[model samples]
Target: MSTVKIEKGQAFWLADPQEHDFPAAYDYLELLFVPEECKAFVDKLRGATTIKKKSKDILRASALPLLPDTNCHVKENLRKIKKKEKLSPILLVRANGKLIIADGYHRLCASYYFTEDLDVPCRLV
Candidate 1:
């Protein structure tokens, strides 16, 4: 995808859709997925394994182009890391043989920068 497209995608997540301000994201959100369907998809991964691997490992596995630096999100995440706050695990969805970071890209980058070998907990969808 083009950088602009990726940025738009990132922005969609950053906007916190629960607040209900982004019509662009809300427009076809239901069409893209339904709760039951998404639940079924996760259920199908019953044998899925959750593992901790190097931050860089996931970046390589993602096969996705580097995301654009939007706000100071990464830096903010890094600050959190510096403060030693616990970060939630990143979620990944495997689609068409590529790992898409469904959430927590900034946290991943910050963890990777702190230490390339930082163990990041992740699970596939």
Candidate 2:
């Protein structure tokens, strides 16, 4: 079998889906994404791992910190905040640079008004 390797220092990039694959995607919003409030606050979160070699390393191998998901109300506020602040696409921090969110899909469909996309920076630890 030929092995397809995910290079070191690379992350599995997922976009903010503009259109969900399912018709009933919003039927169970809570189950799709976890609430941020439920997470425990960590005093110190570790930084991203720097790649030294060509070997592949799964991110789960390291203890990563989780940033809270934006809430429904706050998500709406992001839209207003974006208009007022003139914020750019959401920036997700990486060990190398930032990932720009091409879209804030859920917001567009009125699944939830506002944006959790504003001022939110994310990094996979």
Candidate 3:
């Protein structure tokens, strides 16, 4: 199953920044596609649409590239999520009508690999 039902819209969550495993160097580039952009974009999208979608569907909206190879971090996140350790909601941004993953790509990949029906919580900016 996919996450979003269509190509023109998406779902997301939004709020002030909270530190995670995200690398510090990302702060500089955050203005682009990483985290900051998602928040900014979502805030702009506010009130324009209200959408909810499954994890797999959201991934389809992103059209993100495959990881190519699993890293120790991704493998660990997969194990944890499979075991029911709740992960933080993913962060996403809209650009040219496409959902860009600003964070939680690994977690998304893991969830999709196991089940497309997973409810992925996200914050869109």
Candidate 4:
């Protein structure tokens, strides 16, 4: 697993997605897809290999507005980053010629606060 060492210390990412992240992804995906499809997507995400991608590129590809510092989730992720905690790799799905952030939107936004060029770990399917 690759770690992005920010000025404070090493902001590490887990080699595999956290167990809870899969259900989170499935839940979020349900908002966009049927339950059965959501499960399939989550399964694919689970089997996907971890890859590094630029944080800015992901935001652009997903067409998601960056959550501001005041966002509770973003704030929490920022705290984790500052404390040098291990973060879960994001889960992504490609559909309709667009990118969907299945999970870890807050982490991506928090990492972007440090540097848009930061290479964030993701399990893209």
TM-score of each: 0.60, 0.18, 0.59, 0.91
Q: Tens digits of per-residue lDDT for model 1 on 24-106?
A: 22232234567565455444333346566678888999865434334387767655655555565666667657676655677
Compare the candidates by lDDT and give the number of the best one: 4
**Which regions of candidate 2 fall more than 4 Å away from where they truly are?**
1-4, 21-24, 30-125
Steric overlap count per candidate: 0, 6, 13, 0
lDDT of 4: 0.87
Off by over 4 Å in 4: 1-5
lDDT at position 23, candidate 4: 97
Worst lDDT run of 10 residues, candidate 2, spans: 37-46
Using TM-score as the yardstick, the better of models 2 and 3 is 3
List residue ranges in candidate 1 displaced over 4 A. Answer: 1-37, 42-49, 65-71
Model 2, residue pairs in steric clash: 75-114, 75-115, 75-116, 76-113, 76-114, 76-115
Per residue, candidate 2 scores C-alpha lDDT tens digits across 1-125 of: 11123334332223321123221222232243343311211101113222221111111222222212255643553444444432212211222242211222332222112221212222222
- Candidate 1 TM-score over all chains jointly: 0.60
- What is the lDDT, from 0 to 100, of the residue 22 in candidate 2? 22
Worst 10 residues of 4 by lDDT: 1-10
Q: Which candidate number has the best TM-score?
A: 4
Q: Give, for candidate 1, the lowest lDDT window spanning 10 residues.
A: 8-17
Give the alpha carbon lDDT tens digit for every residue of 1-125 in model 3: 22222222222223323355234224422666657664455445332233345777887888876452266656766656545555556666666687767667876776665556766766564
Scored against the true structure, residue 44 in model 3 reaches a CA lDDT of: 51
